[model samples]
Target chain A: MPTRTPMEVSIAVAKAVQQADVDVIAAYPITPQTHIVEHLSELVANGELQAHFMNVESEHSAISAMVGAAAAGASTFTATSSQGLALMHEILFIAASLRLPIVMVVANRALSGPISIWNDHSDIMAERDIGWIQVFCETGQEAYDAILHAFRVVRDPNVVLPMVVNIDGFNLTHVIEPIYLFEQEELGDYLPEHRQSLKLDIDHPITMGPVGIPEVYTEAKKQVEDALINSKQVILAAWQEFGRRFGRAYAPIETYRVEDAQILLMTMGVISRTAMGAVDRLRDAGKPVGLIRCRLWRPFPLPEFREAVRQASIIAVIDRHISLGAHSGPVGQEVRSALYTLPNRPQVFDFVLGLGGRDVTVHDFLEIVELAEQYATQGPPESEYTLIGLREV
Target chain B: MAEKVEKRAIIGWRNLALGCAILEPGSSMHLLTGTWRLQRPVVDPEKCNQCGLCHIYCPDLAMTKTAAGTYEPDLNYCKGCGICAEECPKDAITLVEEKE
Candidate 1:
């Protein structure tokens, strides 16, 4: 029987990793992500988990070390937050391109300029094209489940791409929730004994990441791109199987109360729950508003997104990070691009809010919905995005 | 034991080893660096000393000691860097511009 325990999300994440029986974990601690690696180290020290827990010098070294470990056919894992993820930026591409199935859990946080250690999507937004399978979790339970599903999808024979499980820093990462932690035997055959087909073997004597001279550079990249797109099948299958066994269903796009709603509010990460509450209140108030949460970010899940917004006439896209010079936020930009080809696409209203861990409540989401409806009459704003909670001088 | 590895041509991306990893060692030998040479080194066996300085100084290991104890460069793999000519104690090697 699975044990449901009320534990800190980070600790629960560590327990999930322990359950997966990861062979190596090389991580550098950063706030919001510290508890995760910290508990993993404790598990290793206490003889609870038989794995090599490496306290790496930096996130760069952490990811680099994972690449080496994964290439050596060892199941590897690592966790990091904002600046740490940014530090691993260079090696991130290398890990994905080299096709090492190293799983990483990113406690989503704001990137620094004024040096804030708070929650936001800036760090991951900066790495939108890293070619890794990226997913966002709305709750601690989802975050914990995502870790197990990540190992299954990435280590699959046809999908040997690295994966990133993004959980909102401080919001979801530091929260204490009742999570159903499964025993190893309960996960029977979910993740089999990992044996990577292509790995660094002294007996075989093969080189990895060899110079892809001009002759095969494009094709080499094409291969990884195809692998990432193709991996969606395995990702969905893992989620389906997990739900069948564990009873918590997940999808690329999760919808709530869109039956006859004419307006939809789209969100990602922890804010989705607040948006769901806002949808409930709005429905009670006779406003035809619904909610759509993007659970999968990479490979973009175009078909599901389009189908989710099929009946809605307008969509209010909530983005946590401003794309600097771009007219809209990164998530908003992607939504617009994805919906551009449709003859009857929904009018997407973009909002930039909750940066550097500012409090976002159901009230804030309600106002966003009102503003989206208000702007729908005006046929797109001149500024393209409404910056929520920005104080005026 | 080190196995005998042969040089092979690059394959298409579909057939390329995972991540384009080179499975065959010593594949660099097929590159033919001799065509990169702007000048060629010629050895004069008559410079009189059998000192092996030139053999030690050739960066590419292109110089080989003949049975007579004189070093001769295999131009097929030599890029004519002239390090052997400069290091020869008796000036037994000369650099000559390659013929067009």
Candidate 2:
């Protein structure tokens, strides 16, 4: 139809979530991501949407409100950015293990020391292991599609896990692109009604958050793990169904021009588009190169990753968040672990780049490839973490 | 008077959709055999200061204090979610599964 802006994408997301019948809205406002909450607030204020808008005092409370609502048998949604997301750390893990299907939109922004209001994965990175079904979006349409599929994944009978659909803070959150909007009737047909056994009830109340001992403690964690691991099948089925309706399919790891590549570039977030451009340039010049976009970050599709990297000899992983003095960057460490556990693995390496939305140009992409080619023959460097996009002293 | 609706997903409709309800509606024992017998929160009278962390954190609000300053749990309301035992700063509570 017509062109759309990042704000339009978020509006579409809110509307679609509304169409999907989200019963509760909990969120805090911050730059870059501020438009999402601001617009959603207008919809609620104008009586365009019917849901409890928990204008929580903090990101922590925003998350907690959703947690409470989800337990109350409401399909809940929330949004946040940067340090606001960091505030929700404690409850994010709780939401996943408790198996309450709360869907959230995180306008990915950088954590501050220097006060950045730009696009970066630092916000989502800090929460890598919080056990939510994480989806990274490259475009506005992807952002809209991710929210719909996330609802299906998060609420699946087997995979009652919360989900976070993240788009790069200002880059995607503030930018504009046309979205393939869904009709309310079609959205309802695709997403079923909120259906969880009333985990909360006043008449016959049951405890929501409880303490566990050694005996049941392991089982609690085990149940979550089993649910998360088992969710793989259900997640794929939902995505397939989503594609059937939305006309776009998202894989855990999507490949670009890697059929017979000499080097592979692995990354996430909006930067993948730039890396793909590098892939094309390298390919045109007869330098076999491919790029893999990690769309699903948590409950990492290990099998698919293992399969994707099996053919490549040298792989370079670019991380948007740093572990700080750690062996590898967050996503890099995850990639290494996944590949190491696989029977057929590649010589995977990683670098920390674009923290606080630092610009990572095509030249930087070449530097990553140079390192990958070096590792292809010499093996992984002695030290794991390499800081890229930093000016040498 | 409270009205109730059957939880279709929790009690899967596939079987019902296939025209097999064994009994129409209330003919079967839906009150699960041992759900009530499992892990009741036991309070340690000697250690309990009755600070009420247990009462507040209990998801179901199963704990309440009497006018005499003694805390007690309403077994009818406590599904043994264990938040009480876990949140009790003094380790004043324990949960053990019971048969009766």
Candidate 3:
């Protein structure tokens, strides 16, 4: 049995990579995500983990190097956040389209205009359509386990796609929590040696990423889209196998006390923990309320999400990022679209909050629930989304 | 005919992503680019000294040595770049307008 140790999530992530025994790590230091690659560098330096740790100049070079490493048949990994992730935007698509099974941990942070290094989903949300398997972690333990699972999921032959595991910046990344650390032997049983049949080898001499002219561009895109959409099965299989092996189960949409509830609060990342507290208070006060934490953000888990909120009449979606000028927040828009065709769908109220590391307390969640209830009865407010907890000058 | 071959190339694969990738290096040789030429280079055998200067300077690798030890330009793959004609010391190659 693996021993439970209290440590920072960043350390746990590095330890998971160590256990997986990745072949290459190309990373540049970025705030919140720095500790993960720093610890990884230490592990490599100490000879505890046998991997090539390339300290690159920038995040773009880091990701570009990983693309080359992955193409060369190496199990590659990297970590970045915020501006770093933005810098790697162009290469992110190429990595996915080439079907490189590289795993990345993105410490989700707000994109800067005012230059705030804080926790939010804007960073990863801006990259939602980059064609990688994206998963969000709500706790330190999830962050640890998800990294291991990401390797297994991405390396699956049926789903040869890159994966991004999003951990809220400074919230889960810097927090210390008790997590079960897996033994290297046990990890060997779960994740085997990565052997890609199609790779850049001198003996085979293959050319990857060729020009797709007008006659072939659509088919190439369809191939990538189909691979991403079809990867959901492999994702679920990996989670199930992990549960059976490690005794901790995970789901795409994890619900908390949703049975017979009239109103549900949907959230992602660490805010879901706070929302659970609000649900407890609302439940104790004789109000039937529930919470649903969205774990898998990409390949968007449509069927599971629709079923999770099917019984609720009103759903308050707490978005940590704003999709300016859109009808609602990113998650809100996705949820509404998923449930649009249902005969008796719930009314979704978009509440944008906690941008730039603003605190979202139980009181705020309670207010959001009340406002959502009002919107349900009053047929929505004038605006598509309401910005909560904003101070008026 | 090149368009037909390109269409066949696009549809002949089971997996488009893997198929779109050129698994064999230098496979672009299979793609006939000769039709891209508006003017073709004609070798002047009478004026040609077997110096192989045009063969050495052909950008497309279209010029080849024949069994008689004379250099000839393979028009099937040549793009009519006129580099060989311009570089031939013996004036052994000339570019003529290709007509339908």
Best prediction by lDDT: 1
Query: What is the C-alpha local distance difference test score of each model?
Result: 0.90, 0.76, 0.89
TM-score of chain A, all candidates? 0.99, 0.94, 0.98
What DockQ does each prediction reach against the true complex? Answer: 0.55, 0.04, 0.38
List candidate 2 segments past 4 Å from native.
Answer: A1-7, A342-344, A378-382, B1-100
Q: Model 3 Cα RMSD, Å? A: 3.2
Task: Give lDDT tens digits, candidate 2, residues A287-314.
Answer: 9899988887777898898888878877
TM-score against native, each model: 0.88, 0.78, 0.89
**Where is model 1 more than 4 Å wrong at Cα?**
A1-3, B1-8, B31-100
Order of quality (DockQ)? 1, 3, 2
Candidates 2 and 3: which is better by lDDT? 3
lDDT of 3 by residue, A1-393 (tens): 567799999999999998888999998999989999999999999999999999999999999999999999999999999999999999999998888899999999899978979999899999999999999999999999999899988888888889999999999999999998876776666986798878988887878999876656787777878889999999999999988978889999999989899999999999999999999999999999999999998999999998898888899998999998788899989988898888898888999999989998999999999999888887889998999988799
Cα lDDT of model 1 by residue, A1-393, tens digit: 567799999999999899889999998989989999999999999999999999888999999999999999999999999999999999999898899999999999999987989999999999999999999999999999999999999889999999999999999999999998887788899986788998988999888887766657887888889899999999999999989987899999999999888999999999999889999999999999999999999978999999999999989999999899999999999999999999999899999999999999998999998889889886667899999999999
Looking at model 3 chain B, which ten-residue stretch has the lowest summed lDDT? B10-19
What does the lDDT come to for candidate 2? 0.76
Provide candidate 2's TM-score on chain A. Answer: 0.94
Considering TM-score, which of the candidate structures 1 and 3 is the better prediction for this target? 3
